[model samples]
Each structure stands twice: as C-alpha cells, then as structure tokens.
Target chain A: MIDRLAVIGVGLIGGSLARALRAAGQVGEIIGCGRSQENLELALELGVIDRYAQDPAIAVRDADIVFLAVPMGAMRELLASIGPHLATNALVTDGGSVKNSIVADARVAFGCMPPWFVPGHPIAGTERSGVGASFPELFRQRRVILTPLPETDPKATARVRAMWQATGAEVSEMTVAHHDEVLAATSHLPHMLAFGLVDALTRMDCSDEIFRYAAGGFRDFTRIASSNPVMWRDICIANRDSLSAMLARFSTEMSDLAASIRDADGEHLLEVFARAKAARDGFVDGGKSLAEHN
Target chain B: MIDRLAVIGVGLIGGSLARALRAAGQVGEIIGCGRSQENLELALELGVIDRYAQDPAIAVRDADIVFLAVPMGAMRELLASIGPHLATNALVTDGGSVKNSIVADARVAFGCMPPWFVPGHPIAGTERSGVGASFPELFRQRRVILTPLPETDPKATARVRAMWQATGAEVSEMTVAHHDEVLAATSHLPHMLAFGLVDALTRMDCSDEIFRYAAGGFRDFTRIASSNPVMWRDICIANRDSLSAMLARFSTEMSDLAASIRDADGEHLLEVFARAKAARDGFVDGGKSLAEHN
Candidate 1:
C-alpha cells in the first residue's frame, strides 16, 4: 500500500482514482492539487481526497506515488513543476488520453527518461467532469494501459500496475506510440467527427428544422459532441498526426459513399453497408464477452 | 372509421400501422400483403391483420384505404400494380422516408395527380425489422409528417391525418421537397456517416484491434450502422440530391476541423466544439419537452 499518494488536477479522473484508492484501503493519505480551490474543497468534503494543496510541488513532496490527471495542455507545465519535488523513488503515472506527447514532455521536463515515470491512461470516463462527477467505481473493470519508457524501473511499473489493480482495473502494457495511434483512431477521431457533424448542421440555413426533425439515431450518433470542448481540443492537437490521417481516410470513404448514391449504385452501396453492419455486430458481440469476463 | 385498410409490404411499418388501427378500433378489416408469405403469415397470426394476400392488386381491390409501406425501390412497381385496383375514392398513402420521390413515382404510375395519394413518413423505428418486430404502439407519440400533393383532395388528406391521429401519432403537413430536405440532413446524413465510419475502419489493417478497443461512444455512434443495409441503400439513392448536398457540406466542415488539428488551432477547435455542445444540449432539452407533452 502507498503511504501517501498525490493527484494533480483533481477532476473526474484524478478524483475518481483517489476515491477508488481510499475505498480499497491502499493509500494512507491522498493529496489533491488543482487550480480551482472550490473543486479541491469539494473533493475533500466528498472524501475523495484526504487533504488539498494548491501547489503541485508541495503536494508531491512526501508522496510515494503521483498521478497527473490534468488535460494534455497542462501536462508539461505540471510535470515540470512537480519534477523537483517528487521523492526520488516515487512512482509517477498519468491518466492522460494521449501518451506519446506526455512521455516526450516528461523527458524534457526531467532532462532524461525518469526511471520512476510510468506513463498510463485509464480508458474510462463519462461526458461529465469535475470533482462532483467522481465515483469510487469509475475505474472498476476498466482498461488501464501503461506505456513505460525503456529506462523506467520495472518496480515502479509494477507498483503503478498494482495500484490500478487495487482499483479493479485491468492493466495492459503497450508502446507509447501504439497507445496514441490506437486511441486516435478509436476515440479522438470519433469525437472530432461528432463535433464536426454537429457544427456543420448548426451552420445550415435549415438548422432549426434539421435539429427538430433529427431522430434518436442522430442524437445517439452525436452524443459525444456534448463532451468537454477544451479537453477534446487538447487531445486533437496532441494526437494531430494520427487523427489527421484518420480524418483523411474517413473523408475518402464518405466521398465514395456519396458517389455511390449519386450513381444510384445499389450493389456497391449495399456491399459497403452490409460490411459495416457485420463489423459492428461483431464488435457488439466481442464487447459483451469482454464485459462478462471482466 | 375506415371500412377496409390494405397494407402493402407488411413489414415493421405496415404491420405496426395495422396493429395500431385494430387496437384503436379504427378499421373494419386489415389486409396484409407482401412478397414474403412467411412474414405475411406471421402478421396474420399476431392479429396485426385479419387476412393475408400475395398480390398487391387483389389486396387493394375493395379497400377504402391503401398504405404502401414498402421500400423506395419497390414503391414504383407496387403503386403500378395497385393503381388500377384502388377504389376511386380510396385514400392512398405511404410510409416512405423520402416523400418527393414517392409522390413523383405515384404521379407516373397513376398517369396524373391522384387526389387520393398522400405521402407520409413516421419518424420512428428500431434497428430490427420484419412483421415480428412490429408493435401496436410503434408510432404512438411519434411525429408523422405528411406531404400531400397539390392535387390531393382536402378530404382525403384529413382522413389520412385522422387515421394517424387515431394511432396516437402527431401529424404535421409540409411540402414534399421540404420534408425530403429536412430528413436528408437529419436522418440520412447521420446514417451515411455511421456506415462510412464503420466501412473505413474495416479497411484498416488494424481493423480487429480498432473494433476491440472501441468504447461506448463508438458503439452508440454506430448503432444505426447495424440497421438493414438494403433499406439504407434505398434511402441514400432515393434522396441522392439532398443527401449529396449534405455530404459536401459535412465534408467541408470536416476539412476545416482537420486543418485546425493540423495547425494546432486550439481556439478554433474549442469554439466549434462548444457550439456543437450547446446545440446538442438545446436539442436534448427540446426533446425532453416534446416527450413530456406527448
């Protein structure tokens, strides 16, 4: 068990992690650090954190473990601020969605690959945010991917993995580049598409009528459009290369679909649509088994 | 009350309408007609219809009202066969998603504007199809848009409106072109995007991994992709012009978004995403009120 754990930028991810560790009785003291005093107060009152600190440096001074759960935009500055204060042997991990950039930023901040630094991302969250949205079971049965630097100490990685396991998360390891690429395709690109679709509809002359007549299908398809704009913006910029490639690929597919419609190519349209349906059906079945196994 | 109701293409839409009419005691007899004898028999056994017929011509022979609930591709042929059999005073209507084409097809099939022809579309359905998936309350509290031709008799329009009202659907009237345009932007475009996204992923070398790691957001966004491909393919072709226009517009927006990501234009991305979130929130709020009123 960790004697003291420090969580910077105490929002949904950090707050949830803190709460989970407390419930598991795996951490003796949890320190929450954030720019918003009100959020830290709420986290403390909710018992998600044992204490609150406005300074990241002070928060990690005596901590055995540190979790940087801030947005991608804030990761570099926050890492720099806490780098000097973290105990030499403290295990460092993060819950950022993008990993390559974060790992690079950590390297620059620490002046090298920090043996104690273990980059991780828990693939779990809802559209909600802030301390009020945190729950002890948020990471239960979720996938937490750890992408450690080559110079990282194996013991530090093991400690981070054990912490996630204590929170009921299944931990898996992958390269930082692969984590970024896979997430860009599965998560970032989807959010961008949703945001772009809704933004496009809003610009139309018949925008009101379009939204009024939109059925349940449209609503579900664009649900992620309601996600946090700032957070998503940071993700898009951080994973620009992979996401741009994905966007271009999707645009090509859409263009082909449009052409099929224009030519009334029923056979081609049917083939593409049938393939999509079968793929989605397979995904749903696989997801069910994953859930059952978890 | 109608003396007789002939429902052509007895699948989800037609079977649901017949069941609703019977539940409301609004029809004397319900005749189900379809190419699939097994589906028609299922409708007969479920009491969605009182009898079944293999020939559309014979089905509408003595019926006072005929509802063509077939796909867009089958509409022309079915209208041709039943045109000569429909009673002179029969109120002929349809449940096609795209109204402009159906109305145009009706004119060609009938040799002129038929005063009894009304084009209607119920903005409701699940992913499942066939008569077995039909239910009496399928259209209850749903919007049923009716686009009547200029030559349509006011009495015939009123009769069709009242029939839908008896099934607990809210009926609204609009120009055929307007209905097609609005639905193309709201429903057709979203479905095509989902299909295209799924199809694109299947083409990737990491297709299996992509699907395996897809989260709940991806599942919800692509749920409509699992719908019947033939039905969607017909929709894409039937509403080609409007859908193509929408596709071009959406592609432009996506390109702008991609540019923002490539340039790391966080402000532009945030502005677009924030606008989308606010719009989606408004739609959700409006939908809740609509549900409450219903």
Candidate 2:
C-alpha cells in the first residue's frame, strides 16, 4: 500500500486516480496540489483527496507516490518544482496525453533518466474536465499505457502497474516514441480535423443557414470540436512533429477525394468510401469489445 | 385528404414519409415502389404502405401525389421513367439531398418544369437505411425544405407543404441553388471529412494500433463514415461544385492550423480553437431546440 500519494493538478485525471486509490484502500493519505485553490478545495470536499497543497514541492515532500496530471505544456515546470522535494524512493508517473516531451523534460530536471519516473498515460477521458468530473470508476477496464525508460527500475514500473490495476485498468508497456505516434494518429489528428471543420463552417458566408440545417451526422462528426481549447492547443503543439505529418497525410487523402468529385469520378469515390466504411466497421466492432471492458 | 399517395424508391426517407402520412390519416391509399423486392416486401409487411409496386410509372398512374425518394444519381432515370406516366394533376415532390440536380433532371425529362413538380429535402435521417428502419416519427419537428421552380403551381406547392406539416415537419422554402449550397456546407462537407479521415488512417502502416487506441472522440467523429457509400458518392458528385468549394476553404483552414503548430504559435492555435469551441457550444444550444422539435 502507498503510505501517502501526492497528485499534482487535481483535475479529472488526478482526482479520479485519488478516488480510485482511496476506494481500493491502496493509499493511506491523498494530497491534492494545484494552482487553482478552488479546484483543490473541491477535490478535498468531494473526498477524492485527504488534504490539499498549493505548492507542488510541499505536496511531494513525504509522499510515497506522486502523479503529475497537469496539461502537457505544464509538465516541465511542474517536474522541476517537485524534483527537489520528492522522496528518493517515491514512484512518479504521469497522466499526460503526450509522453516524449514529458520524458525529455524529466531527463533535464533530474539530470538523467530517474529509475522511479514511469511515464504513463491512461487512455480514458470524456470531453469534460475539472475536479467535479472525477469518478472512481473512470479507469475501470481502461488501458493505462506505461512507457518506461531503459534506466527505469523494474520494481518501480511493476508498482505503478499494480496501482493502476487496482483501479481496474489494464496496464501495458510500450516505447515512448511508439505511444506518441499511435496517439497522434488516433486521438490528436481526429481532434484537429474536428476543430478545423467547425472553424471552417464558422467562417463560411452561409454559416447561419449551414448550422440551422445541420443534421445529426454533422452534430456527431463535430462533437469533439467542443473540447477544452487550451488543453487541445497544448497537445497540438507538444506533439507537433507527429501531428504535422498526420495533417499532411490527411490533406493528401482529402485532396484526392476532392479531385475525384470534381472530375465526377463516381467509381473512384465509391472505392475510397467503401474502403473507409469497411475500416470503420472493423473499428466499431473492436470498439464494442473495448466498451464492454471499460 | 389525398386520394392516393405513391412513394417511389422506398427506403429510409420514402418509407418514413409513407408511415408518417398513414399515421396522420393524410392519404386514402399508399403505394410503395422500389427495385428491391425484399425492401418492398418489408415495407408491405410493416404496413408502412398499403400496397407495393415494382414499376414507378404504374405506381403513380392515378396517384394524386407522388414522392420520389431516390439517391441523387438515380434521379434522372427515375424521373425519365415516371414523367410520361404522371397524372396531369398529380403533385410530384422529391426527397433528394441535392435540389439543383433534381430540378434540372426533372426539366430534362419533362421538357419543362412541370407545374406540379416541387423539389424538397427532409433535413433528417439516421445512418441506417432500408424500409425496415423507417418509422412514423422520423420527420417529426424536422425541417423539410421545398425548392419550387418558377413554373410550379402555387396550389401544388401549398398542398405538398401541408402534407409535410401533417407529418409534424416544419416546411420552409428556398431557391434550388441556395438549398444545395447550404447542405453542401452543413452535410456533404462533414461527410467528406469523416470519410477522408477514416480512409487516411486505413492507409497508415500502424492502422491496427490507431484503431485500437482510438477513444470516444474518434468514434463520434467518424460515425458517419459508416454510412451508405453509394449514396454518399452520389452526393459528392451531385453537389460537386459547392462541396468542392467548401473542401478548398476547409483545406486552407487546416493548412493554417498546421502552420501554427509548426511555428509553435500557441496563441494563434488557442484563438482558433477557442472560436471553434464557442461556435460548437452555440450550435449545441441551437441543436437542443432542433432536437426537441424533432
């Protein structure tokens, strides 16, 4: 059991982790840390955390485990602030969507790859955020991917895996680069397309009529465009290389589709659309299994 | 109040219209016409129509009103087949997504815009199709747009509007060109983006991992990619001009976003994202009213 667990940035991910640990009797004390006093207080009142701290260093001073759940852009600053005060044996992991940058930042802050620093991401979340959105079951049956450095201690990695398992998550390990690339395609690129589509429609001369006549298909396709802007902006910049490559690839595909339409090439358009439908069908089948597990 | 109502190409839209008219007691007889024997049989068994016919011309022989609910690409063939057989006083309306194509096709087949020909589009549907998926409430509170030609009889247009109203739909009128332009932005462009995204990911080397790790956002954003390929292909070709214009505009926006990401212009990215979020929020708010009406 963790004697004390410190969670920096007590929002949806951190608060949910704290709640899950408490329910599983895996942590003796949970300390919430954040720049937002209101969020920390809300976490305390919700019983997701046992106490609160405004300073990251103070929060990690005596903690047996520390989880940094802040936005991707804030990871470097947060790691530097807590590096000096963290107990030498404390197991540290994160819930950031992007990992390469966090892993690199950890190297800079700690002077080397810290054995106890296990870079992790829980492949679970709603468009909603903040402390009030926290729930103990958020990670149940969800995939929590750990991208451990070569210098990481096996014991620390196993401990982090076990903690996530206690919350009913399936933990898997992969290289940091691989994790970033996979997420860039599946998550980040989709968000970019959604935001771009909505932004494009907003700038159209017939914007009002377009929105008024939009059917359920349009609504579902652009639903993700309503996600938190600042958080997504950070993600876009943090994973720029992978996301930029994906954008170019997607643009090429779109251009080909446009050409087919322009030329009235029904056969080519049907071929692309049929392939996409088949692929989407497979994805939906796979998603059902994932949904059942979660 | 209609003596007879014939619905050709009985599928989701046509079958639903027949069912809604029956529920409202707006027709003396309902004749379902389609090429698919199985679909017509299902519609007959479901009592969505009072009878079934394999020939469109024979089906509309003595009908007071005839609804052509076929894909945009099939509009020309269907119009040609039924034009010579249409009753001189029969009011003919269609549920085609693209109005300009249907209007032009009707004029070509009939030698002129028949005074009774009214092109209409119901801004409603689920991804699922076929007669089995039809329901009486499909068009309730939905918007049914009527695009009447200059030669259209005002009496016939009023009757068509009244029939849709009896089914609980809100009927509005717009020019054929305007309707196509609005739907090109609201519906066709979004579908193209969805199909393009899915097709792009399918061509990736890590396609399996991409689909496996995709979250709810990806699922929601690509749900429409699984829609009927032939129908969407037809739409892509029929509304090529407007949809192509929208596609270019969207590409420019996407390129601007990519440039922002490459330059690490976080402020610009945040501004674009914030605007999209606000627009989507307003859309969701407006959509709530539309949802309530439907």
Candidate 3:
C-alpha cells in the first residue's frame, strides 16, 4: 500500500490534495515542493504538508507516489528534474487539465513511458487559484478522468484510481486523445468564449455603467473570464489543435445564430435556446461528480 | 404625497415595489393588478400589496402613482388600455428593461407624450420570478436607472425618484435610446452568449458526462442560461437592433481570438487572456453593482 507521497508545485490543486490526503489518513507523510519558499512555508504552516523542499528532485526521493501539479508548460522541466530521483516502484501522476502533451513529455523524461506513470485530468477547479484557496473537499463529488495509455501498468493505474477514490473523486478512464477532444469541447471552448465575450462587452463605450447594472445573467456569462490567465494560456496552447477545431465549430454555430437573429427568425432563436436549456437540465439531473476532493 | 399607488403585473418586480412602498409607509393604499388572479391573490396574501384588481383601467383610477411592471413586450398593450385612466396629475413610471419602445408606445397611446410618464429600469433582480419571490429589500443597494423623455414632467420624475429612494436604490437618469443601447451590450448580449455557450457545450456526445463533471466554473458560466426564456426572448426582440449590432461587434472580436488560436500564437493568446483578467479585476475593484444578493 502507498504510504508516503510528494506533491510538486503546491498551489491550489496540490495544496488541496495534501489537505485531503492528511484529513482522510490516506498517507503517512506529505511533502511539498515549490519554487516559492514563502508559499512552501505557508503550506507547511497550514499543515497542508508534513515537510517542504526547495529542490524538486529531492522532494520525490523515498516517496511511494508523486503528483506533478504544475502547469502543462512547466511539466516537462519539472519531470526532467525529478526523473532521476524517482524510485522505480513509485507511482507518478498529474492533475493537468490537458493530457496528450503531458503524456508525450512524460514518456520522454522517464526513459520509456513507465508503467508507474498515469496521466489524469481532474474536471474540477475554481476561478480562484493559489494555496490560500485550497480546501479539503474541493474534489468531493467531482470526476477525475484518467487517460491510461495502452502500455500503462495495471497495478500503477489501480493504485492511482484507488488514491483518487480515497480523496472522494469518481475515477473514469479514457484514451489520452479522447480526453483532450472532450475537454476542448466542454471546458476549454467555454472558457475561450467567455473571455471573448467579456473582451467584446468591455470595449463598448457604455459598458462601465452597463456592467454596474448587470444582473445575474451577465455575472454568470462572464464568470469564467475571471480565471487565471497564465494557466489558461498554457492549456490553450498545449491542446491547440483540438481547441482550435472546437473554436472553429463554435464560430460556425455562433455565426448561424447571429444570422438568424439578423433575419429576425424568432423561431430559430427559440429553438436553439430551448435545446440548450433541455441539455443543461439533463446534465445536471445525471449527477456526475463535479469536482475531486483533497 | 402620492396617497394611492397602482402596481401593474404583480410579479416579483411589481410586488417588491408594492411591499417596499408599504414597508416604508410611503403609500396610503397599494393596488396590485395582473392577468393572473392567483398571482394577485398570493401577492395580497404575502402582504406585497394592500388590495388587488383585475382591470388596468380600474386599478389606475384615482391612483396618484402608477407603476407598469409587466413584461417589456406587454408594455405597449398595457399602456394603451391604461392611457385613458392615467390621471393627468398621476406619476406614471415603469419597471421595464428596454425603455425606447415602451416610451414611444406610451407617447402614441396618449395621443401625445404624457408629461407624467417616466421610464425606469431597476438593475436588481433574483433568478426566481413571480410574486412569491418579491421582497421589500430587493432594491436596496441596487441601481434604478430612470430614462425620462424630453416631454416628461419634472414633478412626476421627482416623485418616482423619491419612491425608488424609499427602497434604498440609487437613481440615475439617461436617455431612453442610450439606455437600450447600453443594456444590449451589458445585459442582453451576455445572456445570449451564456445561453449559446451552455447550449453548444451540452450538445456534445459526452454532454451528460460533461455536465456531471462540470465544476464551479461551468456552473457559474451557465447559471444565467437558466433564466426565463420568454422574458429574454422578448428583451432580445424589443432591443433587436442594438442587440444585433452588439452581437456583430462581439463576433468580430471572437473571430480575432479564434484566429490567434488557429495560428497557435501563444503570445497573442496570453495577451488576450491577460487583458481580460485585468478588465474583470478593474471592474470588480470599481465597485460596480453586479453583486448577487442570493
């Protein structure tokens, strides 16, 4: 059974994991690694981790499991630095939003795609980021989709799934490519549209007063536009191909809607809105885990 | 002093106004009118009004203040029926979102612009509709923008403004045309985009799974899409010209962002996200009043 665990890049996701693991008594000790000494200190002070390490490489030593909780762009550098120190028997995984690029990089950094390495994308998070926002139950009732390549070690995959389940997340499996495409349609594309909507709204001359008078409708539409830019930037670039395809498709749909509106086709507008409302209601009723805890 | 007040529609907005007037001891007797007898009965039961009525003409009789709180599309029809009954000395105001069309219709219905008619839109509401959701404090700390036409009476406008102040709402004035244009960008466009985004995302093959896996981000983004579609449909049609113009502008900007993604331009993507982040932060810091009460 896995006992000791190390978490790299102790931000919102990692810090939450540490808190959840410790609260559930799922791990004997949790080690935190980050570039910011102050954040590491804060994590230790909050008892989110049992120890802190300035060097990423040494942080993984003697750990039975390690999570690379950093951004996708930083994953390769992080994996390269920690690769030599990783015990062959230790299972490695990630909480990245995108998977294909990370999976490819992990294969390169670990000599071959180690059986102990599993790629995961937890479909949960908040607009707020950082260690301060970390909560133990952040992932409670949330889905954690794992993209296990064909050569993945069965035992390693099982351990990873068990660990996620212990943290109160429902575990599901998909191929790396499928995960990317699905997330692009559901998550990434929505984010891009939100950001684009806000940008469009703000440029209007009277938007300041308009935003002031904005009801719950505007607030909800622009919510995702308030997310962390750097993280989203990386995700968009890392999964550029799929996201681009999704965006193209979305643009076509939007153009059609706009045309219908221009033509004063009330029937078409109502049809689209009704379809969306029904689909959204159906999804909510289906009861999927919205986020993973810890 | 406005001794008798008539509130048309008796839904959340009208009921809340009636309740506030009674709660503040501002009106001698409040008469609530609506096509829905059940809604009027419940409004009286909830103490939202002092009495109820079925006919627009009878409700406005001898009323020193008359508030038209029906849906935007119904405003013209209501005004036509009540125009003959509106006392020349009475202050006639509305709770409609779009002002230009309503104001124009009011002018035509009265054969000339009634000096006492004032057009106002309160920038406050909850997701729940109908009289049951009405509360005295719904307008507190919220904005109530008034758009008084050139022919509006000064005394009538002052009376309406004072009434809104009694509910603790700050009143601001603008032209009806400008108000419609501004709201199209801020309120209408956002709802349209949110509905479209939710609709687009939920139609995917894994929609049920995606909805199940949706986090706070997706929830927030689509929350507004759950609003009453008929109300939104009326709004879009009432302000179709401005909404269509705003949508065209928004589409142009969305296309630019889509083009950047297609080219895999990380720098451009980061720049766009960064700008949007800053804009949202600035908006929040500006103390703009889009705060959700629920």
Q: Candidate 3 lDDT, tens digit per residue, A51-160?
A: 98989889999999999898888998888888889887888999999999998788788767877789997777877777888999877777889988888998888988
Those runs of model 1 whose alpha carbons end farther than 4 Å from true positions after fitting are: none
lDDT of 2 at B233: 89
Model 3 agreement with the true structure over B1-294: per-residue lDDT tens digits: 459999998887888888887888888988989999998899888888888879999999989999998877788889999888877678789988888788778877877788888899998776568999889999987788999877988888898999998988878898888889888877787778777877777667776656655666776677667666666766777788888898889889888887887777878888888878777767665545334531
- The lDDT of model 3 is 0.82
**What CA RMSD would candidate 3 show?**
2.7
After superposition, the stretches of candidate 2 with alpha carbons farther than 4 Å from their true spots are: A23-25, A292-294, B291-294
TM-score of B chain for each model? 0.97, 0.97, 0.94
Off by over 4 Å in 3: A282-294, B288-294
lDDT for position A44 in model 1: 87
Kindly list the per-residue Cα lDDT of model 2 for residues A118-194, writing each as its tens digit.
99999888777899988999988778899998999999999999999999988889998899899988899889988
Of 2 and 3, the candidate ahead on DockQ is 2
Interface RMSD, model 1, angstroms? 0.8
Error of 1 at A11 (Å): 2.4
The root-mean-square deviation over C-alpha atoms between each candidate and the true structure, in angstroms, is: 1.9, 1.8, 2.7
DockQ, candidate 3, comes to: 0.59
User: CA shift at B9, candidate 3, in angstroms?
Assistant: 1.5
Worst 10 residues of 3 chain A by lDDT: A285-294
**Candidate 2 - CAPRI tier?**
high
